[model samples]
Target: MSIVRNIGAEYQPGKGTAFTVWAPKATQVELSLKSNPQTRVPLQREAFGYWTGLSEEAVPGTRYMYHLDGERDRPDPASRFQPEGVHGPSAVVDHTSFGWTDATWQGLPLDQLIIYELHVGTFSAAGTFEGVIEHLPELQDLGITAIEIMPIAQFPGSRNWGYDGVFPFAAQNSYGGPEGLKKLVNACHGHGISVVLDVVYNHMGPEGNYLNEYGHYFTHRYNTPWGDALNFDDAHCDHVRNFFIQNTLTWLRDFHIDALRLDAVHAIYDTGAKHFLQELREHVGQLEEQEGRPFLLIAESDQSDVRLINPINKGGYGLHAQWFDDYHHVIHTLVTGEMEGYFEDYGKPDQLQKALEHTFVYNGLYSEHRKKTLGTDATANPARQFVVCAQNHDQVGNRMLGERLTELVPFEMLKTVAGMILLSPYVPMLFMGEEYGEQNPFLYFVSHTDTDLVEAVRKGRKEEFAYFAAKGEAPDPQSEETFERSKLRRSYTSDPQQQKLREFYKALIQLRKTHPALAHPDKPHLRVKLDSEKLVLHLTHTGQEPHLYCLFNISNQPQKTQLHAAAGPWKPLLHSADTAWGGPGADIPEMLQQRATVSLPPASVLILELFA
Candidate 1:
């Protein structure tokens, strides 16, 4: 295994851009400037298959391509910016050029974020980084604190889900590349908003992945469909680990990203004494200490392991937060009746009650599908887990047809999920187009040079189970139409339901910001009452001028329910079934509001306030 002497070349910012690409077996490596052959410089690589060079003219916004031994032209896997798309030249950016005013902006703690996940391609019709920025005002009005962007790394062609990224360090040129992304981030921060970058470290894309030429970055001990596993625990693991860690910090330091949502951590597969997640957390903590800026790491794992989000001092990874699927499955099953695979395990309101109250319903209980007890509960730890209605890239792209929750659930149900997510103490997330209910679907896409793989993807989509396994007759992921369709329809911003939904979301977010009782979950204050088909969440805070309460009706029929509240001065704050949301429910107090008796319409949720 060849040692990586210059892993720093991929991320360290500067005027003289120095890049170190691992192409060990190749006889020669040349950095070719786009449309210019005279500037092609030969790389200086040692015995370890690592080729490196420092360029004085490779300034920010400059474009270039990589030529291997006078071979065919190829895009740089580490290209910083691509203004002309994936096939375009690499750009050199001065990470310090952009002035950021978030001096006191300690980013949204993962615990407090009402995350709105969006795909730049699908979030707007323009399908570019700059296009997505146009909707920041709308998102701000929609009551979102952070925008968790899907991967922006360069891939083979125009369209992709970003999971097929080959360029670990570069942004897609077609989407206006690095500068475009920086502009969007700057804009988000200007609006007092934070950004979270979704990074994939599990495996490289099938195409444009020439890293094998450098050294043993992958091990054959375990093989995934994506190919070799990253050598996280074996020999030459230090440099490989640094390669990822540096990329992780670069998003924070250069892009001003508040947090990183680590994708598919279970596939990260680090079997070492000091796990990569722990080390990464330590590095981020150190950076946070030096910069005096609050940053968070949100891990995506299905192991139901507490160590992923546990405190670092407790011999755990100490990540700030993690994605909770238990909450998603419960809510998805209840609303959509999608009990095919794993949803079969969570169709009951009782499941949602446990998820809403205790964080996880399957607390070491027997899972009928897994045929074993899943895992232990989060132990009443609500702050460490983020639950939400939808997140960009995952739910949208996971479907066989790339359908969003908006397509399956009614507008009223959308409000219901939004209320349930926002009112809960846990961090909430929303997918792009969810605020206004976009009609487009978020389909799985990719741009691979190999025609065989493209055909395989089309065939794969025709079959359904998980995302990659959807085997539907699909469009060519590399096609221009596919990429174009991913862009969000900005017109939804003006729709009536869109406006109404936006206000409701904003109200909930504002409520969360103003209320302390909604910040974190404690045992006594939070409790959920539910039947087989209906649920009512009752919450009360300690020590205040009043208390917090939210009543939810998950059934398909209007139901009259009773609650355990003193009901001295009770008033309805908001309802999902109001006429604004196209409901016929009346505002006239039911039973004089003395004992808090009210009629909840089908698939509706109500948030109430008690003034003591």
Candidate 2:
């Protein structure tokens, strides 16, 4: 064994690179440069698994593999990027080689962003970074300000949700790997749209995970439903924390990404004094200061803890935004009447009014899902709060039969839900294929190298539905067919149903952007009136430049009632009941023509902007 392990190796601007690994237990580790016949160069190690070597003579295009224990060569555990597939060898890449034209590019602000979340593999037919660019014009035209992609980190297979990523820095080779991502970022910035990468720091994918050999990166002390928890608080945690921290910065700086959406932060187990999130926030803030623009860190957490956005001076992690699951639940329940499962706590028209009013339903209120009161005092900062159709991803895929909301709710009901979702005071997000109400379902599927793990996933899915076992029908989650069916039906534009849904979404988003009451995030002054026939909610922005939004979440029966809120100059911009355009068939007529004393139809959702 050699005496030195160069953790920080010397840099070569464009030439082939050198790498080192730290494997204390291993007797020998060799660096195999994949050139000509793929020759193996021996490595030297230090005391604590710090293996070092130099490939000064290797070319930039050479594909190299790390051979540990003097046996078969594996990919680098800390590979900066993956060009080939995950199973292939790690190629030498120069971080500064890619020319970026974003010198004047600052970044996107939190509240200003209308984010569209997409999974690269299914986003386009090509399923590569280049393929996604072809669809960028569609996103740009849709009035989206940023694109939030599911993780692209190298996993075991050609496709995944990216939460299972083990190589934190390496981009998935199947999705244009590293170089392709840089190009994507450049293209986005050129179009003045930011890219927010959805990253998973909670747990690594079970397959192609070689972190166990590199260092103490995972722990068995704390168990997660998904195998082992990441090592953030345990032994040798300082380095482990640094590992992830560095990874975040690399994504921002190296990949030219504007923001990171931390996936399932509720699952990130940390107990440090300067908590991991706080540290990450501090670093990101500093980077923003250096870059001189808005760089964001949004967290996907069901725990509606206000401290996540509290400034460091106030002892909070200072995340820019958070995904509000309550918002989605409220909308889902109202539109679909899905009273089973978690939807049991939602579906009431009042819940819709409350979510828009406060941004959280369970704000210390009793939750049937948790079987307890949830959240603390968050009424203090409702604007900084983010609410959305955020229960995307798993919500669409986890269904026993893998179905989307389009499968349940009528198109106009979907449009009404869209009005409420987009017009609310909090930030809004749309899931991939949701804009047009695509019929494909995103299912829970994985290609694990371990056969036993495959069977285990199958059994887990079958038993998960004892609540619906009485139906005597269960989805076959194990079959490759299940995975195939879950892909989005891309023929949305040509399909009549999808075309109408797309038009509805387009109008709703446009209304949100143009209308003053719906554009900003502020808890509006609210008046609720419910009679035997209908429920009407009148909303007014509280502060300066106040505006109004009125909703009639009525039933299928026509009714007209007087509202209690102060009469203001309100014009009906939209009504869900007028369903000549592919929705729940209800026609509330133009009796609402610029007048206070108007009519309402059953099961209608209406929006009228007001000026007081």
What TM-score would every model get versus the actual structure? 0.89, 0.89
Model 1's alpha-carbon lDDT is 0.72
**Model 2 agreement with the true structure over 1-612: per-residue lDDT tens digits:** 112122322347554455666565578888877774456778877556667777776655567777778666777766766666566777766676789999899886666777888888777878789998988888887778788898988986775667778788888888887889999999998887899898989988777777776678888878898877888888767666767777788888778798899988989998767778988888777777876776789888877787788777887788878888877886676556578877887777776666666667778888887798877556666554574773377788677766777777665556656666666667778888888887777777666666886787678877897677776645554456665666667677688777776777777677666665554557644443445236554544433334554565534456675544454556556766555447556544433333355566655567665544
Give lDDT tens digits, candidate 1, residues 252-271.
88788889888889898788
| Candidate 1 TM-score over all chains jointly | 0.89
What candidate 1 gets wrong by more than 4 Å, as runs, is 1-19, 22-58, 61-77, 82-89, 390-392, 465-479, 482-486, 490-494, 519-524, 533-545, 566-569, 587-596
- In order, the Cα lDDT scores of the candidates are 0.72, 0.71
**Candidate 2: what lDDT?**
0.71
Give, for candidate 2, the lowest lDDT window spanning 10 residues. 1-10
